[model samples]
Target: MENSPEIATDAASLRPAGVSAVALSRLASATGGQLLHVPQNADPDEIAISGVSIDSRSVRSGDLYAALPGARFHGADFTRSAREAGAAAVLTDPAGAQILGSDPGLPVVVTPDPRSQVGAIARAVYDSQPEDGSGLSLFAVTGTNGKTTTTYFTNSILRALGETTGLIGTIEILAGGQRIPSRLTTPEAPTVHALLSVMRESGMTAASMEVSSHAIAFHRVDGIRYDVAGFTNLTQDHLDLHGTMEAYFGVKAQLFTPERTQRAVIAVADDDDEWGIRMARHARAQLGAENVDVFAMRGGVVADREEDPDRRGADWTLRSMSRRGIGHRFELVHRDGRSLRVSTGLPGEFNVANAALAALMILASGVELETLQRVLDDDDPLTTDVPGRMQLIGTEPTAVVDFAHNPDALARALAAVDPPDGDGRVILVFGATGDRDRTKRPLMGEIAAREADVVIISDDDPHGEDPAAIREEVAAGARSLVEAGTARAVEVYEISPRAVAIRSAVQMAGPQDSVIVAGRGHETVQEIAGVDHPLDDRAELRAALDEMQEGRWERR
Candidate 1:
């Protein structure tokens, strides 16, 4: 229950400098909330509000403190602290208003649901989208795996096109070159608007953000609309929250609506399940066919499918891909016969999908094909490094760290790293997240057993669940496949404390073998039993390789 130091100081750092204040009454009226408890001498319209914050510890003077209801406690219980921290007023639900009782000594805006209104209020207070329409050209990507990489690619491409860009995603938030550590794939609504305002004030012209399903379900991106929204792919993950894959897809589908994005770019590559195709159809229905662009890898199952004529062609088709170093160089051919040759240094054919989606999104945002092609060919924006995303750490045994936590992602990562024309084995070290999608543990295990020569089940973010239990579930799946004689003779071992498992994987790898540390990619901390332990896969892999090299040198 300790207050976060970042939250305590966020008021000064996260809030944009010289933001134009909006009248308190205007926000209440805009959100259709009842305004009450204004000071006797103050007119509601004259009470200026400079910012918005959901966390009381981050409240600053002239900020509207959004006191929402939580599962355990009502946020209005912290209103006194928010007031002491110089909050101007309170925005809360009726229950929160009741928690404050009467005469709370500040103006209160009461609504039935405050969580849904936080984004709108923050937007108006920060003027994130200026009335003059000179705001950041917002781009958002949402899906299971490639959201982070696609956004990074989008930001890089935007920069390549001579635009000052900002980024909001899993690793960090870059606002006009100022880097801030990120805690979520998409942060809370207030922080989202505040970051956008910072980008605008710092003269950034475009910003790319990763929008997670949790963000959409929780209304984190309530009011802000993107110039272009991209979907990478949907897979079996986050079932703990959404309960069903259908429901999960429903939440991702929300981002492509006309209200959330001006244009939609959907990737339908290898769409055997047809989620991508369904998403494209939904987007086109909602935003009109002109505003929706479908992208596919030319030889993918979906692109080659002859059953449905509607799924036959995409606006952009990735074709003629040839391996370039660890990654692939591919050509993005449009249905209109315009083609742009692009490449991503990041490994995996899926990254080719991510890079293609990024290019299509930029083009959908009104960037000319010639300009985009110039950036792709000349600047090679898609070749930029994305942390923890197929990030290669060593060359001798081919060590890699990736954030492929789900069954689909894990399968793809294994396929990408499998030794091509060698006796090299695929050594995988991975574990399911505690307290999330329990069903995926066995599926991931079975995949590891099937695809990898050696499987080391290690703890990811155990959270509150018992790490041993989580490992056993994954081991059960792997063991089932191995015992059933359906999979290759894979050696599966359960190793704890994660660091040891990583070292073990590295030690087992040979010069031609690949050691992949999957899950928790780009994440430096591992959360277990409400505590964070420092654990960077990249750093650990490098240290292990260094140790191996040092030992070899000594032996020689």
Candidate 2:
């Protein structure tokens, strides 16, 4: 198993150029903290903080180091290191303050809980968000899946409309002309504020971000309110951290509150899943009915519900969809009979939902319908490449690489790649991530068995679990389905050293077959136990196809 790239901890490296400083006294007052160890002759209000950082090692000159308490060691243990790194002041909780003993040789801001105030401190120091609503127009998306693609679609449309845009998501962070690979679905609160400040400093007009459930639960997105927030559907995943699906939903719902966003666009496409409908209702209750918009892609129960006026039909609908090349052409129809014709070259029906959410989110952010329509027709921004998202590598064997790590995503990917008219079979290569929701492992395997013709159970960041054991758990589900003989005939294989599995899948595939390498989409490193190994699914798949082509040339 390979480990994720370490987050860039050097605050100076990530901070925006020429950011104005903020007074330490003002920050303490804003966060309801008390200033301790202020110099006898020095005024606390005159002490300037140029930046904020939670990690001691990331501290820079004129920075306020937030010494927070963690599960194991308190951040105060590194106060000497932070001071050595040129941190001008410190912000810590009561426990951390005690850990520092007396006269820690720096100005200290003591709060009951410093972690919750990190965002506010960073925002104030960086001036990331303006009070008069004058800076970047912020947009955010959250859900089990599609958040990345939706945010990408949103940024692309913003660019098409002639606005320089920034993006913060699972894959990377884009601040106007600057690009940084991301280590987390949502980075720490300080990094979020720093990137936004950078975008603003660069004269970017708008920004889109992915709000993971973990981010909200950990207060990673605090102190910033979005112009619009969109919700993709929720499903089983992340049980290890959240403990339950309901808990996960609650964390996601936090982003829809009036304090967090000015408006919301929610996808309620599935009638069987009430999570979307419930989310819409929650947003409406929090932000008021006028601020929330319900979007339906297939006109499900949400479109027909008339029992309660509050639970009424969809505000926006995606209809009149038809196949357009490998993608689809669809109409986004408003309840008032207004509509916009849009299309996405992306490979899945779920992508249609993603594009729709993006469009509606822009509309919710006050973009005119005509403007969006013209941009859609002229630029077709929705067709832009979202890396590793149903990414096509080859046409002959229909080779694709996708970040579908869960049951819902795996099933959707399989359905999208399965041939509709030809005899080509679906060849799937996938594995469940270790140290995650173990319950989903069998579910994902069953999905692959039912949807694909050949199932290759492989390794995906095994972390600390036994790789063979993880494969067996997944293989058990496929083997059970095969033994029961309840589904179509399927061939299953358990393979290791993921690269070889890619080659084996390609070797067994015919020209008409579709080969999908799911999970760890854009991730280049595969973590085994505690070490990170160099591996990229797209590179391996491409290499295998090139080898096969070379073999044919040699035969000739």
Candidate 3:
């Protein structure tokens, strides 16, 4: 809220995504940028911006193009293209100025750290703030996994309470009723402020978001203030970006700081990982005990599992669960001894934890327990189907689609959907994403082999990396278990063209067998050689099942 500003303007000045026209001098002053050049014919006060975009191709007329540094090349390399696309001004660092080639007569706001400062500039440009004079209640969830599910749960439940809510996560953005695909777990700072501005303009007063470790470290959420910040358990993920486990924990811990958040809702179900414990300690040190609440898994056989669910047995707990057809009716007991009973459409015990954590966030927001009980007591109840998180596709073979992309997620998902003794077989069909932390590839293989009777390794977002090579690494991990005789009945298969692998898994499923299609759950595209080929795991799985029902399904 530091750089937030107020300005009086009419409808003509309002631009796309709710960005308002602002003086060039004002943007420069807010960003502390050195104004390199101004057009000879244009006045600094008269120059106006409609929006901000990092991608050159998406740049629009009267937009401010932010050209930052990238892994392969300087984004400023596209300055001419942005200019051609009608960008009114450019924001970049000194390095980008060099790439922009001395003047060219366009106004350039040059800052030493553009990425860290853009969110503040964006907030000023768009006049993004709660219109009701009350600060917008922003909620966020962070962890290696379950973040998307938690965000959806939090947002959906809030909506059920008759609140206009915005949602941002790894999957998509729901600005009121408008939905858009997510490009990052947490978008760039400017994008965050812009989207918030859009939401406010669309009559939304609150928002739920997923904050990623990379986003925290990169300052993607630099200027936003969250009302409630929740934590799912940390695990082995994004090691490719953060480099080490400790470093990953360190960045994730930043979200709990009092500067970024007000009230905290942390899931402390994981008895193994101490990061959540350390996070609670850190948050209490800054925000004090009253503002921080740590909730952990208290009942159900879920807590006894090896997966660290990050429950601390502290302020609140979930007890007495009665599951009903891929759903559960549970009792949420708070530290103050008050309890609320609720039901969720979400399957898997881990989702019960997600819903409980979300309910605690609602409680922290001052919703009455009786009100929540009434909502849950409704004939329909409040439940959300998070795309690809235990999404069931068939009843005959009992197939499910999930976004369990990593080892811990794969393990927990397998455990959640595992069949009982003499019940049936658990067949897993999955692959690892390319250009990610290679360490998890083999670990994913290990989990599938150990948990499922049939393991089919395939492709997932190969990117620019070789598809065959990525498959081999995962297969090696699963095959290692077979060589060790630990997963004796485990049968492994290596397949390509993901559709083929999915079809094979479907055909192999017998009655009572559960076929899980992991990774790339809600994703609609598969990356290969820098191109996104059309593909959706859910769509493909459904197609495979439909074909099987028609007695025309075949696999090679």
Winner by lDDT: 2
lDDT minimum window of 10 residues, candidate 3: 1-10
Q: Candidate 1: lDDT of 8?
A: 30
- Assess each prediction's global lDDT (C-alpha) against the native: 0.87, 0.88, 0.79
Give each prediction's root-mean-square deviation over alpha carbons: 3.8, 3.5, 5.8
By TM-score, highest first, what's the ranking? 2, 1, 3
lDDT of 1 by residue, 1-556 (tens): 1112122313225777868889998889988999989988999988889988888888889989999998798899999999999989999999999999888988999999889998888888777888799999999999998999999899889888888888889988877446667888888998889889988887889999999999999989998989999999999999989999899999999998878999999998654648988888888779887788888775454344333435444777777999998889988777778888888888888898999899899999998888888878888888888899999999879999999999999999999999898579999999999989898999999999999999999999999999999999999999999999987636899999899999888888788999999999999999999999999999998998998988853311
* Runs in model 1 lying further than 4 Å from the true structure: 1-12, 299-313, 552-556
Candidate 3 residue lDDT tens string, 1-556? 1012233121122233544578877888888789878867778878887677777876778888889998898879998899998999999999999988876557898999888777776666666654455545789898888898888888777777877887778877766345667768787776777777767776777899999998898888887778889988888999999999999998988888877888898777745547767777677667766788777675342223222333224677778899767778888777668887877776788888888888888878888888876766763334767888888888768889999999989998888777767588888889998999999999989888998899999999999889999999998889998999987346899988999999898899887888899998899988999998999989998998898888795432
Task: For residue 365, give model 3's deviation from the true position in Å.
Answer: 1.5
Model 3 residue 175 lDDT score: 60
Each model's TM-score?
A: 0.94, 0.95, 0.89
